[model samples]
Target: MARKPAAAYPFSSSPGSSSARPPQPNTNLNALRIPVTPERRPGAPSPSSATTTSAASSASRNPFLTPSPGTASASPSPAQAGRSTATNRPYGTASAANSSTHLMPPSAASSTASLVSSSGSSLRPQPTSGNTPRAALSAPPLNTSSKSATTAPPSISDKFSLSPDPSLWGGNLSLSDREADDYLHNPDPKRDRKNDRGGTMFTARGIVNLGCLFIMAAGLIALFAGYPIISFFTTTHQSTQGGYNLGGINQTGQVPEITGALGLIDVQTPAASKSHTGWMDQSTYDLVFSDEFNVEGRSFYPGDDPYWEAVNLHYWETNNLEWYDPSAITTTGGNLKIWLNKTENHDLNYMGGMMSTWNKFCFTGGYIEVSVSLPGDPTVWGLWPAIWTMGNLGRAGYGASLDGMWPYTYESCDVGTLANQTQNGGPPDALTTGDPDWNGALSFLPGQRLSACTCAGEDHPGPQDSSGNFVGRAAPEIDILEAQVYQSTRTGAVSQSVQMAPFNAYWQYTNTSNADFQIYNAEITEANGYLGGVYQQAASSVSITNQNCYSGHQSGETGCFAVYGFEYEPGDSGYITWINNGQPAWTVYAPALGPDANTGIAQRPIPTEPMYILANLGISENFGAIDYAELVFPVYLLIDYVRVYQKQGSTNIGCDPADHPTAQYIQNHIDAYSNWNLTTFDDFAAVSGSTWPKNKLIDTC
Candidate 1:
């Protein structure tokens, strides 16, 4: 690493320094130095010469350095004449034996700029008889290689360093070892003033030059300290509030700032609002669902588990090397650990864990927050851990629904025999004008869509036809956070995205060309339709909650946790606001369904169906290629807690009577099945013994 250069020596022009003004022949001339009197060049139309001559002629009663007609007539008082004695000639021209104090006229010392004329004119005037030649006053060529190192260009180290080395400056005399050490190390003005015998000697021009250099250095330091923050709020020229221009990704891959209504707005809360666990709380919202992962030393599996149900994916999705296993899920020390371990499972070399609340917990529009920390740095090859939710039309048991879609048959489920449950009801006909019912044999109810399936044969029925069991042909998929840091090296930039796939007509077209579906970096306006959304990315060093925490993890160690959330209000084209670090960062809304104003493509309205929360740690080849042997065994995705909140008195479609018969469902069916506690934000805080404040406003919109 390059070190900062030593401080430059304070520029104090003395007799020894060529840049110094000509030495005074006596104390009388010392008082004459206050006025800026540049020597007049003969026949030159210089303003400085006229000022100097006029000042001398008028101030003859005062001690003047120049010989003027006014001074010749005025005889100085006896005391003034006695004190006008001198020790040496101007510019040290006196001989050793005879120290005659002959003062050179002020016209000898011309402006430095004029001294170095393009034509080789002498800097000093010719000497009078019995005086030294003008050549004696001229400074010699700088000899950098000499022992004193007088007047050298700045060394390579000094030029590139944060500060300029003082010894290299031409006007400053070469300091001795003791002087250099004292000036560089003890920079206090008191010490400098003490060492300065003839008081401050900096000329006006020298002070101005020093001021300019200080300003430039300050600017550079400010830019270095604030680049991350400035970059986060800068967007491409095409980007605007509520609109994203994915014409191309920046070469730096920076995420653009969100603007307009889509930008973050501070929702003022009550004066005594609480801030517990570093989360600002508002009073208007209620805590409906939360999995604090307080259950210790046990895995949340079937029978007796209160919050989550483990699902075995059986190595049929994402071309992942791991099989989803219940054994890999564990709760310890107030945290949920989803371990990704390398092992032989169902003919797969790796096994991971996943859980969901498909039937147990589901809700419509509200806020969902997950506190999670992931494993591995941005370049950790292939690691895909996500906290997401899927819309649920089937499991909601809206009408004749049995835990919705095709879930693995569970004996405890109240939906009678698995085969006897209600079949696929198909897409909502009113959602569009003759919507294709895209799933065909797959259930029209929304659920997590895996890349593979194998539970049923080729020619199966409505819920589970042979086309590899079933497919999701339902509501949108909200990928709250998905990171692909594997694309960037540890010290390089890290990138992640927030994605939503509305299973509408536009989705059909975009999914066909999935490679170009991403929005990159901007806020999505309602004009983009429900099927599309804005994208965001950040440098690994900048903290962008949930994906990476810039402060916690440094070096190659990846141990980061942060809050990620979203709010959905079903009105005016269905508003959805994405949040990070408890701040509403961006928002997207449903667009006019069928034939957009700009693209003219038929789009689907944002699905009004409820969705169930799901958290999974899946190893996917889609993130990037990975080697099984290179995988870090026992890597885990640690979830501190998962929470969901909603505005009070909102319709509980997930538990409304029109949905299912509660009496036949789990005990305290609404609370048990949904894992939701209905209470005001403050009430919930009291119950949980937390001082954290809750949201007071209704919506970021």
Candidate 2:
């Protein structure tokens, strides 16, 4: 913006220029420099004196030399008629200031480098009291461009008027970024100039502009105030395009701004075969899950929820995976046995585990993979410990199969009977229509399931062999069958992996993954085709969708589903996952299977479909311990290393069939909370049963 036919304001010499002639080029840089720091000694060659020599050398060296004797005559150097001007310059060294050495003003730089008019005319010298003007001009132009061209050191005291070079302060005083922004991006500078002042210091016009800005700001603010849904997209676009680092979780919700829409969920795993300990809940983690499971009799002891458990646990797991750990169960370094006394242990070993709101925790839809590392042990045998999710669902006989719909009933369902339905081929094909234990005898055999726990009359749900009678609290098996999310680890839920086994054991090696360590992952159903932008999806959208009518493209269909599928990346995201031998992980989708759920162009499910998540960890025999568990859907605990990413511009579009799309999950519920176990990043620490201690859910700030 330095407008100039004036050759870009080539050089503006002040009235105090000392050189009578212009210097030629070819001068060494060292010739022109002043002492750089405080160490420069006094009586050193003065920059003014050096300038005199360099100018002579400059004039003698180059053919392009030009001089302005006339201009130099009009303006003598300030030192010639010493005048003090600076108001706040700091004091300088006494010797440097008072010695025979001609001193450069502490405030102003040496005035010897002033450029001559370039006309090559000799300047009319000022009438010196003793010396003749001709005598001053006689020294062969003083080699105008001398080899030692010098400029005086800047004044460090409050003596001389100040003048600084452009380089001294390049980026310090910016035209207020906002004002500059208005000037740059906005074409109208009048209102902007007015508002610019208003933003800093108010004026009449600034106030008016301020009022207008407030109105506009209010309108912009109203655009997505409570409407987390639309706010996610717009704000995300703004943050990314404007250059901001966004959080993976915060992108879905607001950070530093607490909203029911952004909270964690509480999930409890079934007790280990030998020890009964449930999954971690969200309340402890200072977060809330969307969908929650109802427990008959469970105890909550203060902060024993999600928050405290979120502490980095490298030491806990490092010392816990015992040398002879049974394949079934996971052991940790932070031994729970010593930390929690008898009273605490009693509280830790609960009868039933509770679930949080599913809608609140996980993404409504997309592939969420949980990375897990299974202990290579054959002795673990017969352990089925699963990491699955559950939600409320109802089926209406054959009506749900072809018509692509299921009715929501307010009635509680039979846990076993509910399990019988909600499977491929509607019972007869993949599941049993009646009691396979009574009717088919061995027909109910667990296929490759080491932890089936079938002991003749044991197939029935109600009575325990030791307890006798068939009567027991009947809860619908709705979870097992209706559960659409799952993936298995390399081991089983047989009594061996998750519980203690009483016998000499050997760690078995198996590249083969069993059904016991399975997990179920499913995403949420939203109002339209899907939630989230093509590249950067937002959780806020789903949260504010119904409440604020803020949704993405193609709104209007109503099944609210979220993403809870299993992670299947290799090496980096993890070597092993919930299912497969860390390969080909199985993800269950109702009405969508095989090619349909495969994530190809043809497999995308449309419309809003209500969905939930579930996993099954079955233990047939007692396990010595569970090495570790995987959570398909993400939670703060299940991550190897979480990275918050924000993209600029509008690269985000819609769902991608090539890869599973992460849809926004309503963060308002508890059951939707999935685990993002950070243990995934932990350097596998070798531990023994003696050092391994389980974590007792401790809820604390």
Candidate 3:
């Protein structure tokens, strides 16, 4: 491409060009130019002496008016001779005497014309007159010699014009043969490219360097300041509420201090208990009931304590060999004691004590705990001590009418049978009369017939004569801790289980006669029956020796005390968690508790009914054949305390229907049984009236 002439640029200094004045010589460019030293002749003054004198004289003069390099007097001075000699060489090889050559205006045609011709190419001189139009100068022909055979010489516009090319100064410029030879043999340190960068901080490269420095400083500040600002929002705050007061038992008592326990017992406070449970913030719970048994020689009989009653009845349900005598229960040394002694009572060879809060106190859902030392030693066999709870609808001693609440946690229906019963006008005669399968005779109450299909009514001792009579009460059992010797080799283990009979198989066992009990048990032990059946719920067990309990011995062993407890949430979406020695031993969901035996559909039967506590020490008859004479009696089950806590705003109380209202009960029944197995039943909305579904049984307010 043809290059534009110098006068054509907007910055050209030529007269009559209508352009801006030419730019000044860059200080960086001056630093890059190689100052040429003229070779000395025999009779002439040295170039250095002449250059020094001329430069000194020219210091006060206007640099723009300095004479052109070759425009000297006819008899030239020594300085002029040196400047001419330096300018005649290749471009960039100029002496200090001609340093001001670049400051000349373009109208100084002699200086501009000489600068182009000095590169071994001659140029036509431009007119100095303001009105005279200058002709465009063409670039010289490129040198074809072997020295520059491969590369063309830079054009005049590239060398002298104010172009951006770095070669406009001496840096990286192509040198002539003599200059190249001199640079190779006698290099000038001033011509080094590293020293070419000369500019004030306001220049382009200087501004970029400053920007990089600022960026590095900003990154360092961010790195050092980040952590503390993040920690300000994330650190945990200490709770303000103090530890829960356990009836001030820790202050003045002979009771041993509770240790390594969890929930409210471990921390002895609600706020701190949540840190161990990790289930929910327990600070939301309030202490509703507590029994420290601090009084010495206090009776646990019905009239003596408002919260507890000693069991005086013989417990025949499990065919236990021990009769629970109220005389065997007493308080002494700041502890409640239940003594197991060998005696003949109610045709049994042993006597122990069992205490309950059946009609006195109950709760719908909350935290319940008991700390007790079991009786006997680890080697003792047949010793069964348990801490458990049952629904308030059923009394502990009467197993006929009140026993209906023992296992049925949720209401279930035989939809096909109910549909038939509705068409046939009423309940079948087999359900009312003594059909062995539907209503069986109880061993405890021989003449009484209890129907497994119909649960106990809300009215004590009998079913309600109202329309909601068939809507049974929820009375599921939660076994918090039960220690038994299943194997003689392993005796320290304690089991925890949530038991429910949604299919009513437990009723069969309770109502069966002694002659046919084994036959009925065999049927329920099948795959489709009670044992491992679809209705079988989940259970878990852990050895007390493995847990961090007090004394680290078996349940029956002396000096062995463990924390046994459970937390219950009441609703279709609730759960029950069993805590053994302050740790969660097992967890069971509400939906997993009561599944329909026939269809395997989950009933979501978490116990919403109010339940009272029970603590018993009995000798179970189920332990395999062992000589009773080898076991020693007079062992003791010591109770440290029993405590209960309810949610802060809950209004639940013993045997109260406030928490599970009738309207909510109907809605829950509809949600669980509606369209179940593609078979819809009668609407439960009429439960308040006389139109309750014949097939479905639900909880009443």
Clashes of each: 16, 170, 4
- What digit string (tens of lDDT, one per residue) describes model 3 on residues 574-643? 7777666655555555544444343222353667666778888888765334347656677777778787
List the candidate numbers ranked by lDDT, top first: 3, 1, 2
In model 3, the runs with Cα more than 4 Å from the true position are: 1-283, 412-471, 486-488, 504-560, 597-604, 623-630, 659-701
| Tens-digit per-residue lDDT, 53-149, candidate 2 | 3333333342322223443222223222221111112222122222212223221122222222243233222222221111121111212342442
Lowest-lDDT window of 10 residues in candidate 1? 533-542
lDDT of each: 0.40, 0.22, 0.48
The 10-residue segment of model 3 with minimum total lDDT is 441-450
Better of 1 and 2 by lDDT: 1
TM-score of each: 0.39, 0.22, 0.45
Whole-model lDDT for model 1 versus the true structure? 0.40
Candidate 2: worst 10 consecutive residues by lDDT? 496-505
